[model samples]
Target: MKKIVYAGLFTFFVSVISFTARAESTVGYFGFEPDIITNYIGPSSKKMGYVRVTIDLMLTDTSDIAVVEHHTPLLRDALVEILSKEPEEKIKSLTGREEIRAKCAE
Candidate 1:
């Protein structure tokens, strides 16, 4: 009887510890309230194009979500500024799009 109780207690403790660790390591995602929309330079000097993007930030820990929420406005503005400066060709091409994504990640 004592051995069974000890085994059960040990299992419960291990389960609790594992659950806590998993919770702490969980990833969190935060999305912008309104999609970012901005105008970019078109193929020709006389033309102009606009792009709309929805961005979601992935955080390493769920607790960091609040920090991201607090700075959402600034993050949206920065993304808009980055997109607005891009040329139409870069905005449309795959490689260019990847580059833009990398820039945004930075």
Candidate 2:
């Protein structure tokens, strides 16, 4: 009985440690501060509307946080460039939003 109990406890501890390690390796998220705001073209060529978006980047590893922080300016610029060119109609639709998300993911 003592040997059985010891073996079970050892297995549990090993499992717990491996689980913790795997959890640590899971994806990490970094959200842009103050959000991203950009202008999109409205129905009238002379008029433009602004859209505000909160962007979050999913990093393959938590250690990549610093790398993302370093390139935040470039990322923000790319997002703004994408959003600014979209029409107001597309910007407000659900499917269009998903399309924009897909573009961002690329």
Each prediction's whole-model lDDT (CA): 0.90, 0.92
Q: Candidate 2, residue 81: CA error in Å?
A: 0.3
Q: Could you give candidate 2's per-residue lDDT for residues 4-44 as a string of tens digits?
A: 99999999999999999987786889999989999888999
lDDT value, candidate 1, whole model: 0.90
Q: Model 1, clash count?
A: 0
| Pairs in clash, predicted candidate 1 | none
Give the least accurate 10-residue stretch of model 1, judged by summed lDDT.
22-31
Tell me how many clashing residue pairs each candidate has.
0, 0
Instruction: Please list the residue runs of candidate 1 whose C-alpha ends up more than 4 Å from where it truly belongs after superposition.
Output: 1-24
The local lDDT score (0 to 100) that residue 40 gets in candidate 1 is 90
